[model samples]
Structure formats: structure tokens, C-alpha cells
Target: MVDVMHQEVVALENRRRLYTGLAVVLLIAVVMSGYHEASQLNSGGFLQGLAKFFDYPAQIVAQSWEDGWAFWALFPKFLPALIETLNIAAVATIIGALIATVLSLLSSRNLEVPAAMIPVVRRIMDVMRAFPELIIALFLIFVLGASPVPAAIAVAFHTSGALGKLFSEVNENIDVKPLEGLKATGSTWLQRVRFGVLPQVLPNYSSYFLLRFEINVRASAILGFVGAGGIGSELSRAIGWGAGNEIAALFLLLFLSIVAIDQLSSYLRRHFVGAESFG
Candidate 1:
């Protein structure tokens, strides 16, 4: 018994030593990669870059919020733009969620589809989601011209891409028993999908849609950088014209709005998924 216990201790020590060595090697590799990138970006002047980041924001925020009340006082001025941004997010989320429902059914690998079309459809979705939201905003701006139209278009495209992928994942996680039961009922493909697949995945699908709505709210604010008119356009303009006070007002507004939207979305999702209902 003593010898057996001793052998177990030795084996445990060997595993610990092996793990420690691998961790050290991984740390060294990560550090080397970071150092290489930093060097390429002129790491010798890193101190100066760090100084600028804090200093610039400090100078701007300090002068802008001279009186705490000034920020709140400016809320009225931003209210209209804030509403517009919220509208963009709402419209985009609803429209995108609707479209994504269809595309997700097509894109789900577990669902039956013509074998020849699978790769083609999947690749198309991959390309759509692969592009960043801002890039899509820029492209929409060019196609639709500058206005809320472009911003909504960009937001819709972004929401569609993100929500579709999420929707597919939700579909993939569904319980398979309902599907088999529906099949045994002599149901057609459409009937099985409508009765069996949709019900099980609906809860998770709502959660994904609401979550993506939260992201779209934030993204639409920055769409203005690409000429997609929304609160982001106004925020960018405020910064451009050196209205630090206005920018401060916008920042406070953004924080409050996003927080409210997040809470509301969480409540709705939980309620819909039968976790809890609104109080």
C-alpha cells in the first residue's frame, strides 16, 4: 500500500510538471507575438501613445462637464436624436428577425435540403456575417446615399447576418423527438417544420433576436461615421465641431439608453422563454 501511494504521488507530480512546462511555453509564444506586433506599430513610442489616450479624453471630458448639471440640461436637445436611434434599432431588429427566421431554416445543417445547394447557401451566409457592421454601413451609405435610410439599411443587413447565424444555432439545439413524432404523423416537410421545429426553437430564437437588437442599438450609433444618419452621425458631428460638452451629453445619453434597452430586452426574453414574466 505504501509503494502504491508513492507511485500515485510520482505520477501526479509528473502531470503537474508537464502542465507547467506547456503553460510557460504558451505564455512565451503569446508574449513574443504581442512584442512583434507592438514593434511593428512603433512600440518604442508606446509611452507617448498611452499619454495621449488618457490626456486627450481627460482634457475633453473635464472642460465639457464643467458643471454636472450642464450634461443633464442638454438632454432635451439630444432627446429627438435618441428617439431616432431607438427607432432605427427597433425597425432593424423586427425586420431582420423576420427575414432571419426564413434564412435560418434554410441554413440549418440538421434540416433536410438538396445536397447540391447546401454548400452554396452556407457560404453566402458566411460571407454576409464575416463583413463587419461598419463596412456594411459604408456600403449602404454609397448605395442609398446619406440619410436615416442608409443607416437603417446598414443596421438591417447587420442584424440579418448576425441573427440568421444565431437562429441557425437555436434550430440546431432543438429536441429531436418532436421532429420524429411529426414525421410519424405522415406530415409533409412543411407541416413538420411548422409544427415540430418552430415550437421548440421559438424560445431560444426570441432570445437571440432580442440580444441582437441590443447590439444593433449600439452599432447604429456609430453608423454616422460612415454617413448613415442616426445618433452616431450627430455624435460624430459634435466631436468634429469641438463641442465637447455636447459629446459629453451624448455619452451620458448613450450609456443610459443602452442600459435601459438591455434591461428591457433581458426581461422580455426571460418572460418569452417561460423563465419569468414581467412584474
Candidate 2:
């Protein structure tokens, strides 16, 4: 009986290994084929482009070094645009997080009041998240006429969808006892969610919100390249005019701002969510 059982286990293990090996080979083949197609479509092929990848950076650095004083001077001139980008990100994150909170509660299976609205809310979030912020910004820019408003709206739309999905997943893991107890006392659905759900999930939600804000900051800048009116537009102009010194200065400002935001958000997330929560 032991020998028979051992043989069965060995056969199962072999079958699993066989399936895994085949899947890995298929993945590699797909990747190679995709890369080959992309290389063919690319103007100079992948290898040729890869060889010259550092040339632009080298030119920017050399020019910036030659005009070091001018590069430093660009910072003060560019400060307002940096502020505009930050403002867009901040507004988007705040508005989107608020919307996400409401949608999360409505979509969560455990906390949803209507039960039937789960699929509807989930699908709405899916649609919202499916469109990239850049695409939304471009469309809005055409209608809204190239301003930070379109960028903010675009980031906020995507943020709400992304955070709603995350927050709903967090909601699903909460203990049901508090909710049940609140319901037993004839508490309103809103009351139960406010007292029972919010406390348990606030830490995770805050962490996710901060992370999303960091992402939106970068998105806001990128959207500006499409004439959404922020630092990105300024950067695009510098590049178009071949102002290497200005480009370097703008890149420095963006890099510093992103690093500062990342550090601050990381600290806050750690404080709220705790390192152990991730483990």
C-alpha cells in the first residue's frame, strides 16, 4: 500500500513538472517572437537603438556642464511650473481618494448594502481603470483646450478606479463580527460602515492613497507633455528647441521632486501600515 501511494505521488509530481516546463517554454517563445517583431518594426532595430541609447544623455550632460550657471538659473524660472504639476497631482489624489472610498464600500462583497450592485460597481471601476491617464488627458485636452484641469481630471479618474479595486479587496478581509453586531442593533448601513469598516481599513487605504498620489504626480508631469499645462509642457518645449541645459535643469527638478515625494510617502505609509503588515 505504501509503495502504491508513493508511486501515485511521484506520478503527480512528474506531471506537474512536465506542465510547468511546457508553460515556461511557451512563455519564452512568445517573448522572443514579440521582441523579434518589435525589432523589425523599429526604425534602426533594437540592437542599433540600444547602442546609441546613452548618446542623448551624454549630450544633455555635456551641455548642462558647459552652461552650469544657466542650468542653475532655470530652477527659479521653472518653479511655478513645478508647483502647477504638484497642484494637479494633489487635487487629483484628494478627489479620487474620496470617490474611491465610496465606491469601495459599495463594491465590497461583505459591506455592500444592495448585494446586487457589486458586479455593477466592479465593472465601472474596471472601465475606469482600463483607460490610461494619458489617453484620457489627450481627449480632455481636445475638449478642454490644454490646461492643468484636464490633467487633474484624467489622473483623478484613473486614481479612483485603481484605488477602488484595492480598497474593496481590503474591505473583503475585515472581520464580519463588528458589522453583524452593528446590524443587530438596527444601525444604519452607513453607520455600520463608518464605525466598523473604516477603522479596520483606514491604514491600508491611506497607504494605498499615498502610493497612488506618488504615481499621479508622475502621471501629471507626463500628461503635461501632451499640452496639459505643467512642468511636462515646459520640458517638452525645452526638448523641442534643443535646449539641453534647460532640459537638464527640468530633469533635475522633476527627479528631486519625485524623490522627495517618494520618501515622504514611504515614511507615512510605514507609519500608518507598519512594516509587519506587508510581511
Candidate 3:
């Protein structure tokens, strides 16, 4: 009994040590990834390539606002624009979800494929996901002429790559029984996917779409800085002129909108997940 107890204690210690090592490695990986992204986003070469409207700190501080209360006055004006920003987010997410769903079945690991072409397709998806959405917006603004259309296209592409990847992962993890049953009944590959895959993943798909919409809401609000229309344009304009109150109101509205979204997304997620019942 004494020997068994000692061995159990040793095994527990080893498991704890292994978990600690894994946690440390994961933390390091996350930090490195964030640093790499920041470096890429701020690269001078990238800025030059995009020809983004530039801001100079010196020019900004040259303007004046003496009263703190003046900043608070600007929020009310941003309300309508904020709603427009949320609409852009919703519109982008809906369009992107449809585009991505089609791509996802093509990308799913479990899907029957022409063995040689899967990698080619996946690489295309990877390229789309690798660059930031803002970069896509920049290009769209260039080609599409800086309207909300460009902004929506940018969000759609970003969401497609991301949500497709997630959907593919979900596809891979689903129980094989339903899929096998379909195949057993002489179902074509497409039919197998239609019946087997869609049911299991719809909850997760909706959840991801909602999350993307939340991000897009924030993204749309700022797309205007690059001439892609949204409330972000006005907010950026106010900030440029040292209209601190307007900026504050815009930011506060953003905070409230995001908070509301966070709650709504949580409720929807739980409802879909069956953790909470929806009436």
C-alpha cells in the first residue's frame, strides 16, 4: 500500500509538470503571434503600399480644447452613424456566411475530394486568412472606390476565410455514423454532406457568424478612415479636428454597442448551444 501510494503521488507530480509546460508553451506562442501581427500591421512598407490617409501627431496637438465638458457633447451626434455601422456589420456577416458555407464543404477534411486538389484549395483559404481584414479593405477601397461596398467586401472575405476554417474543423470532428449511414444508402458525396454535416454544425455556424458580426460592427465603424463609408469616417474626422467631446461620444457609443452585442451574442450562443432555452 505504501509503495502504491508513493507511485501515485509521483505520477500526479509528473502530470502536473507536463500541464505546466504545455501552458507555458501556449502562452509563449500566443505572445509571439501577437507581436508578429503588430509588426506586420505597422510595417512602413505596408503603409506606403496602401497610401492610407496619414495623420501627424504634431498637426493633431496643434488644435485646442480647454474644457472637458466639450468632449462629452459630441457623443449624441454619433448615434445615427453608430447604428449604420452595426448595420454594415450585420449585412457583411450574412453575405459572408453564405459564401463561406459553400467554401467550407469544399475544405472539410472529411469530405471526399480529388486527392490532388485539396491542398491547392486550402492554400487559397490560408492566403485569405493570413492577411488582416483591414488590408483587404484597403485594396477594396482602391478598386471599389472607398464606399461601404468595399468595406462589406473586405469583411466578407475575412469572415469567409475564418468561418470556413472553423466550419471545416467542426466537420472533421462530427460523429462519423451519420455520414456513413448516408453513404451506405447510396447517397452521392454532395448528399452525404447535405444531410450529415449541416445538422451538426448549424449551431456552431450561427454562433461564429454572430461573433463575426460583432467584430464587423467594430470594423465598419472604422472603415471610413480609409474612405470606406461608415460611422468611423465621422469619428475619425472629429478626432482629427480635436473635437474631443465628439470623439468621446463616439467611443462611448462604441462601448455601449459592443457591450450590448456581447450580451446578445452570449444569449444567442447559449440558446443555440442549449445551455439556455430561448422562447
Candidate 4:
């Protein structure tokens, strides 16, 4: 019996090794075929694009070096555009967080609600998250005549869905004792949620909101490229005119703003949510 068991174990190990090897081979084959197809479809072959990738950056740097004085001059010219982009992100994040709060509570299982409504609200959130912000912004730009307002609304719509799902997940894990105590007092649903749930989850919610704000700032810039109204629009114009010197300046400003925002949000998240949460 001992000999038979040892043989069976060896056979099982062999089969496991075989299966793992087959899986690795299949994955490699798939990756290679996908890369080949992509290269075939690309306007420039993969190797060709890779070789020329540094050419544009080299030109921009050379131009900026030659006309470095214009770099400082362009900063004031574009300051308002940067402010507009930040405004769009800030407004969108706030609006999205507010909407998410209501949806999250309604969708949370621990919270009291009509059973049918839960799936309805969840589906709405699903639809919201499924649409990309860029597509929404383009559609809105067509309707609303290309302003920051449309970009804000588009970003907020997507943010609401994204944050609502996260908020609901946070709600699911909160302490229940306070909620039970609130209910025992015959407290209203809103009262119970306000006093019981909000305190426990607010840190997590705020952390997520701050992260979303960082993302929306970048998204707002991209939306401006499509005619939304921000530094992106100005950047687009510079590119169209082949103003490499101006492009370098705009790039520098954008890069600095993004890094500053990232650091600030990271610090705030660590302070509010605890470092372990991010880890």
C-alpha cells in the first residue's frame, strides 16, 4: 500500500508539470502571434517606430534650447489655461463624490432599501462606468459647443459611477454595532447612515476621491485637446502650428503640475487613510 501511494504521488507530480509546461508554451505562442498581427496592422513597423521614437523629443529639446527665453514668456500666457483645467477637475470631483455618496448608500446591502432598487441602482452605476470619459466628453462637446462645462459634466458622470462602486464596497465592511444602535432608537434611515456609517467609511471614501481628482486632472487636460477648453487646447494649437519651443514649455508646466498634485494627494491620503491602507 505504501509503495502504491508513492507511485501515485509521483504520477500526479508529473502530470502537474506537464500541464504547467503546456500552459507556458500556449501563452508564449499567443503573445508572439498577437505581436505579429499588431506589427502587420501598424502604419509603421514596430522596429521602425521604435527607432524613430526619440526624433520628436530631440526636436522639441533642440528648439527649446535655441529659444529658451520664450519658454518663460509662455508661462504667463498659459497660466489661466492651467487654472481652468484644475477648476474642471475640482468641480467634477466634488460633484462626482456627492452623487456617489447617495448611490453608494442606496446600493449598499447593509442599508435598508427596496430589494428591487438595489439591482436597478447597481446597473445604472455599471452603465456609467462602462462609458469612457473621452467618449462622453466628445458627445457633450458636440451638443454643448466645446466648453469646460461639458468636460466637467463628462468627468463627473464617470467619477460618480467609479466612486459609487468603491463606496458601496467600503460600506459593506463597516462596523455594524453603531448601525444597530442607531436603528434601535427608531432613527430615520438618513439619520442612521449619517451618524453610523459615514464616520467609519469617510476616510476611505475621501482617499478614493482624492485619487480620482488626480486622475480627472489628467483627463481634463486630454479633454481640452479634443476641444473642451484648457491648457490642452493651447497645446493642441501649438502642435498644429509646429511650435516646438512652445510645446516644450507647455510640456514642462504640465509635468510639474501633475507631479505637484500627485505628491499633495499622496500626502493627504497617507494622513487621512493611514499608510497601511495604501500599502
* Residues 2-35 of candidate 4: C-alpha lDDT, one tens digit per residue: 9999999999999999999999999999999999
Q: RMSD to the native, candidate 2?
A: 3.2
C-alpha lDDT of all candidate models, in order = 0.81, 0.93, 0.78, 0.93
| TM-score of each predicted structure versus truth | 0.79, 0.86, 0.72, 0.90
Candidate 1 at residue 38, lDDT? Answer: 85
* Candidate 2 Cα errors over 4 Å, as ranges: 1-45, 276-279
Q: For candidate 1, what is the lDDT?
A: 0.81
Clashes of each: 0, 0, 4, 0
Q: How do the residues 123-231 of candidate 1 rate in per-residue lDDT, one tens digit apiece?
A: 6667767877788777777777887777777677767777887888888888778878878888887897899899888888888888898998898888867777667
Ten-residue stretch with the least lDDT total in model 4:
270-279
How far is 6's C-alpha from truth in model 2 (Å)?
9.7
As for lDDT, the candidate ahead, 3 or 4, is 4
Candidate whose TM-score is highest: 4
lDDT-wise, the better of 2 and 3 is 2
What local lDDT does model 3 show for residue 205? Answer: 89
Report how far off residue 92 is in candidate 4 (Å): 0.7
- Better lDDT candidate (1, 2): 2
Off by over 4 Å in 1: 1-44, 276-279
lDDT per residue (tens digit) for residues 1-279 in model 3: 999999999999999999999999999999989877876878474446456543443333332244446555566667777877777788888987887887777776677766666677677778768977788899877777867888888887878788878777887788879988999899998888889988898888888888888888888877878887668898788878876555656667788889999889989988887775542
